[model samples]
Target chain A: MKAVKVILVLFLLSILVIGQSYAGTIKIGAVLAVTGPASFLGAPEAKTLEMLVAEANSKGGIKGNKLELIVKDTGGNPEKAISFAKQLIEEDKVFAIVGPSTSGETMKIKNIAEEAKTILLSCAAAEVIVNPMAKYVFKTPQNDSFAVIKIFEQMKKMGISKVGVVSSNTGFGKAGKEQIEKLAKDHGITILLSEVYDKAASDLTAEVTKLKANNVQAVINWSIEPAQAIVLKNAKQIGLNVPMFQSHGFGNIGYVKAAGPAAEGVIFPAGRLLVAETLADNNPQKGVLLQYKKDYEAKFKEEVSTFGGHGYDAFIILKAAIEKAGADKEKVRDAIEGIKNLVGTAGIFNFSDKDHNGLDINAFEMLTVKDGKFIVLK
Target chain B: MNTQLFFQYFVAGVTYGAIYAIVAIGFNIIYNTTGIINFAQGEFVMLGAMTAVTLNNFIPLPVAIILAVIITIIIGALIEILFIRWLVSPSVLRMIIITIGLSIVIREVALHIWGDGIYALPYFTGTALKTLSVGGVFISPQILWVLGICSITVIILNLYFKYTLMGRKMRACASNRSAARLCGINAKNMVTLSFMLSAGIGAIAGCIVSPITYVQYDSGTPLAIKGFTVAIFGGLGNSMAAVVAGLILGILESFSIWLMPTAFKDVISISILLFILFVKPSGIFGNKEALNLKEF
Candidate 1:
């Protein structure tokens, strides 16, 4: 009886010691699409978060507390994201959740995080994620509206008022169409033609040919993946010679390469990561962007995409929030809202009650494909 | 619409349709011999396109194309020998489920090997296949290549099946497997040959379309669906019907975009297909007698 009591007392003491040590660590939850069709988005994001956490912990972490990042793969599915968000908030008791890589998944889990009263710093680009003032949610990527506005600004500078829009039938495409339609008139632009194609359509020649017939000055395509690249190739094939602009979805160099020579002179709006080297010395995002680019490339042996940049900014913003507010969820939420002038790979973030993204049209840089690579359009 | 607009739409439809037709022909080959719709037909197309793009870095384009086709043929044959041959007694339902499962496996394996980046092959002629402007309608040379290759493939297949001894044995197995086996023809060997032939054709189709569409690991299913639709419309195992049906589907899909919103393209095509099936239960060119036979 005496030996049994002694062993139980020692086990309790060990539990107390382990618990005390882990109590000082901050836990951040991430839901990324690491293996699904959107693995392109999730793979880089997971890498970015892992790298940032390791780097911070190596340097003694934020405010001298060790950082623990728990990443879950959603495989780009919304149901998976919601379940993961619940696990992070209810079971793991993370102070904050950083991502559910795609916009659709982020929206699906927004209420969960809000109910849990934990901050969600999403890496996805949809405007709906941040608009309407979701108190507990913030995002790093420039909103789709900002991407549209940036494209329009470039169009205005070139004196191209009449434009044609070819958007995909998917959520991203449909949302982009709405933004373009809503903002075009405000920008003194007239949409000559607007059409939505199947995201999986093998060819868009008919659509391009129709746009050319309508005599639009420029064409804007909004979608992800092969659709964006295929439109450019189809335009070249059917001789739609006007300037073509794509949404931020065209950020990846792989798309540019896929379009081959057809990608030349086609412009799009994207984050600063693609043009990190070309950013001027005084640019706010330059230093951090360069460091991230070098570190990521060195470790992964692949070029850094803006999707990864979004992940990097998520942790960066969270680190700042944690530094100011400690590990309290409510305080972290307020800290995240209070963050301002935080230079990140996406842009300088300035959060407020009215704005969660804290980014405007300026967050995007107008980039054009030149010689199978992205070049900043001066 | 003006002549130029019509021509532009026509060219677009034909180009797109030709890809479907080639895939349809591939389906016809396997379906004719085994009475099974090789659901992995599209994977063969994807594999061919992916392999060619991968090989182009090391070898010349022409050599890469040939090698890619050969590789697909070998893969098809291997699939037959290893998986399909082991089926206790092949039923259409069982064969279909197996092919579907195989397709998923192939796509996942492809993802692991190549990653998920979209890849495109260069235009075969070195430069962007110059768009030939005829009276105001622009047509890409790639379109011509697609149409040309598709037609040649159909003609060569027809000639081979009609003339070659090995092809005859395969046809004999298709018409009556038991009789062919009784006559000392190896029905299983003929099935294997048919798979190889279909895979080769599907691979070539992939190579032809890759420059325009850009091939991804997941591209096979859509291509397969489109191809299956074309095959059904043309009468399942009829080569000539496949070509005509492919052209018709492609042109209609293109022209419909002008008449209605782009979203209705699939709706319009599938509706037309349904209407045709409603009118003639045995597709446009499919022989009812052949379809009635359980073996073929």
Candidate 2:
């Protein structure tokens, strides 16, 4: 009995020490694909959150407490994400969590977030992640359906009727193609062909040949950058003179550089233009963009891509929402949902009850590659 | 929907099958010599592909390929000496777990160094994609490359094993490490050599693939699994059989794409492997009684 008491006293003393050392910080846990193929998204999400947290503290923090971001890398795997979410919740005692940058990874942790009543702001853009609608869950990232909707609007404006969409057989690609097909019909666009590429595909000529024979005016590419670029190169090689309509993903200059001159006239609905001249002065978010651009460019010492813009947006939205909520969990959730006309590096992000995504069609500034640089379409 | 479509899918499957076969060869070679199934072998493909792309961005294709291979060979050897050398005598399960953990670490390190974003790599020569029509079924140059590489790798590896003294010593080390040590052969070097060779092959696979399919950091794991499965089905330690096994999986998956949804392709392969394990534990080309739980 005496030994048990002595042990209990030591445990209490250790707890006191731990509590004393790290206290008064509003902890927000984040899960990102920090070490996988999707690290492209997670790295930015992680970096953006840090910048936002630092900036928030510099301005006296949210309601006088510093914002602490506890982050984990999901590595683009869904199974690993569930465990990491649990770790952040139980071990870290975080106030809320953000993460699992891909839709596939985000889907794995949705139930855990619901059971824990922890607010999860997912970065993946898959429509199915939140289709069933979990409470305490919202996404700042755009979904496939919205992307398709944005692309459909552009297709309608381009006056192109006959369309061909080639997508990978993965869940994300299939869903996008399905939504594009449904929206294409609603938008009065004729579907010329629908093709599928193997996930392990290196060449796509056999698939492209069928699409090429269809006499489509434009091709909607719905695959990751590598396969998508393969399609563009092969299509151009086969002398298919159709305009290619790409998803927001093709906005990366790396894709353009990979496709070389063949990527010219390829139109995509970009979430943000990292180096657009328009955002420097006259744009509404000029101040924010200017600050973010200055910091990001200085750190990485390379030109920022649209992905960096996403990083800038994720962190800013969280900081602003936290400030408005004054550290109250319910209030912060409310603040995030109630965010109206909140200017971000991406654009003026306005969120409401009906819409979870803050950005709209206007946010997707249409752009094309001209002379190796993105020429913003008027 | 028709026979022509069937033929198209079949041809597609054959092309894929060939690539997996080449991937499997690396698995077979490493397993044959080391008795340790290195999971990061797939990362060699990622590394190789990424390296080729990095090099190709600045230099010519031939030079890029050469540089990619050399870098991968060095990486493979270093990984063996650094990580696998200590785990050489552990249980196969431990080795497998260690390799998977190492793979995770490798992928994370890759992610940190190379930020996420899908990169598009062009096929050889940065040339226009060319297709051949054989008997009304269309085949692309990429398929030809995949098939050509696998064939050459199989023949060369088989010849080396049969002819070269170093290759014979490798076989000896794989078969009887104690005996090989008694014969004054550097058994440790043999293990490292196997890793280097496997890495070179994996690099070639990656280089050819990135230009064809597009690679990301996480893409290596699935390919690694597929490669392991092909080696197992064909005979885990049989390099030549790995080639056949890779092709078999590719063609089977290609046909299955038409018969079933592509999402369950891995499931189908898993089921097939399970059946094979239950009925024929020795695999296609392996010894029936070689199932002893032994050390490297």
Alpha-carbon TM-score of each model against the true structure: 0.95, 0.80
- TM-score of chain A by itself in each prediction: 0.95, 0.91
Task: Give me the displacement of residue A294 in model 1, in angstroms.
Answer: 0.5
Model 2 agreement with the true structure over B1-296: per-residue lDDT tens digits: 66665677677677667777788888878887777788888898888887877788799888988998999899888888898786646677887887788888877677666655455456554344455666666666766777787788889999898899999999888887889999999988998899999999999988776655667766677777787888888878787877777777777776665565444556777887887788876677777766564352
- lDDT tens string, model 1, A1-378? 999999999999999879756767988899999987889889999999999999999999888889889999998899999999999888888878888888899999998888878889898888888876688988888888888888888999999999999999888898999999999999999998899998888888888888977999999999986999888878877878899999988998898888878889999989888998887889988899999999999999988999999899889888888889987778888888898999988888888888898877788889998778788998
Instruction: Name the best candidate (by lDDT).
Output: 1
RMSD for each of the candidates: 2.4, 5.1
DockQ of each: 0.70, 0.26
Candidate 1 lDDT, tens digit per residue, B1-296? 78888888888888778878888999999987887899999999999999999999999988999999999999999999998887766777888999999999999888888888999778876456377788877777777788889889889988888999988888888888889999999999999999999999999999988988889998999999999998889988888899999999999998988887788889977897898779875688877776787543
lDDT of each residue in A1-378, candidate 2, tens digit only:
999999999999999889746656888898987655666677767877777788778988777888888888877788889998999888886788887788887788888988888888887777665566776777766556667877777878889888988888776677788888888878888887777766655555556556655678889988764677778876775557788988777767777776777777888777555445654366676576667777776776766666656656666677778777776777887788898998775567888776666767666667777877777665
Model 1 alpha-carbon drift over 4 Å, by segment: A1-21
Docking class of 2: acceptable
Please provide the root mean square deviation of candidate 1 (C-alpha atoms, Å). Answer: 2.4
State the fnat of model 2. Answer: 0.32
